[model samples]
Target: MSRLLLVVLLLANVGTAIGVVYARHLHRQSFIELARLEKTRDELNIEFGRLQLEQATVAESNRIDAIARTRLGMKFPEASDVVVIQP
Candidate 1:
């Protein structure tokens, strides 16, 4: 009976050790995955900033006015063409 009890205790200790190793492996894997995600997030943030700058440059009023004048041949109305109506 005493030997049987010793064998059970030894088996339990081995099982616990195996569990500890598996837990450590999972912790390492999670750490590596977190680092990879953080790097991807930083790269996306940089790309977002660049896109915002490009959008601002493209939406400038001066650039739009230049395009309108050159491409569409749009011009401001002359004073003689202005008609004032008193209502």
Candidate 2:
């Protein structure tokens, strides 16, 4: 009976050790996954900032005016060319 009790205790100890190992492995996997997602989020944020800057540069009035003058041959006329028509 004493030997049987010793065998049961040993089995229980082995089971507990296996549980600890499995839990540790899962914890490590989750930590790695979290780090990967954080890196992706940071990269996306940087890209978003660059896109915002590009939008601002493209939307400037000075840039549009320059393009119109150079590419489309648009010009502001003299005061004498202005005519106001009243209905």
Candidate 3:
């Protein structure tokens, strides 16, 4: 009876060791994946910031108005040139 109890205890210890090793391996893999994902996220964030700056520079309303006034010779009409059109 004593020998049987010893055998059971030994088997339990072996099972526990195997479970601990597997858990450690899983944790290591998860950390590596997390690092890779974080790197990708950072790169995307940089690209997004650059695009935002480019959009602001390209679509400036004040610049468009300046170009229209200086280059196109367009002007706002005076009260005489204003036509009263009603539908």
- The TM-scores of all predictions, comma-separated, are 0.81, 0.76, 0.74
lDDT of 2 by residue, 1-87 (tens): 999999999999999999999999999999999999999999999999999999999999999999999999999999999999999
Task: Order candidates by TM-score, high to low.
Answer: 1, 2, 3
Error of 3 at 63 (Å): 4.3
Question: For model 3, what is the alpha-carbon lDDT of residue 30?
Answer: 100
Model 3 over residues 1-87: C-alpha lDDT tens digits?
999999999999999999999999999999999999999999999999999999998789888788889999877789899889899
Q: What does candidate 1 score on TM? A: 0.81
Query: Candidate 1: lDDT over CA atoms?
Result: 0.98
Candidate 3, position 53, lDDT? 97
What shift in Å separates residue 86 of candidate 1 from its native position after superposition?
11
How many pairs of residues collide in model 1? 0
**lDDT for residue 86 in candidate 2, whole number 0-100:** 100
Whose TM-score is greatest here?
A: 1
Question: 1-87 in candidate 1: lDDT tens per residue?
Answer: 999999999999999999999999999999999999999999999999999999999999999999999999998899998999999
Backbone clashes under 3 angstroms, per model: 0, 0, 0
Alpha carbon lDDT of each predicted model: 0.98, 0.99, 0.95
Please give the lDDT score at residue 66 for candidate 2.
100
